[model samples]
Target: MWVDRADWNCCGEPFRIGSQVTWELRRDIDVRWLMEALGSDTAVSVDAFQYHHGDTDVASEQTSGTVARIRAVHWRSAPQTGTVPGSGVLTELNEADRGAPDRGDLTFEGFLVTLKQ
Candidate 1:
């Protein structure tokens, strides 16, 4: 196979930065949904970025510097499973020099806790 480079989405999908939202796992969900529905949370590690995309919010390329942002859900406190000791990354975005789109995965332990709300 070719040794592909660059993350699945590069710098991250575009976004307006300010208009963003986030969610956490509840204790009443199922791991199956986290797996079958959106894609296997196992195919990739929760630590590794997953998928991403973006587009311009303007009618034309009038604003060249106009940039937005994309987000990902990385499980810091992943499962207390066989994973290495202390795998908590804490998911939070910070002000950036123009953040980009990105994707991510969750470890098995994370998968269990994320949806098992």
Candidate 2:
């Protein structure tokens, strides 16, 4: 689920594929709350960023590197109307995320994240 509430704030245009970066949560609340309210099902995108692809009982987008099973999430809300998680699971796992080749600290400007895919 992608956060899209009128009260909620979004950073900027979505990045492209192969762009490695880190992003922080905009709100303090869990996205599951919004997901349950909007989405009927959920699943994480295989991409490291977890780009939303809508609800599905079976995994969608079988293309290699495009389908990662995000444990047990079943989002039913539409991307244009769902809530995005505030956590940074994707960047945390990939130790070689943005930042430097050694340190993994990320820099942020408002909500913009810079990284290397």
lDDT of 1 by residue, 12-88 (tens): 33333453422211122233323332344442322222222223341211112221332232332334432333332
Q: How far does residue 71 in candidate 1 sit from its true spot (Å)?
A: 8.2
Please provide TM-scores, in order, for all candidate models, with all chains considered together.
0.21, 0.23
Which 10 residues in a row give candidate 2 its minimum summed lDDT? 66-75
Against the true structure, what is every candidate's RMSD? 13.7, 15.5
Global CA lDDT of candidate 1, please?
Answer: 0.27
Off by over 4 Å in 1: 1-17, 20-85, 96-117
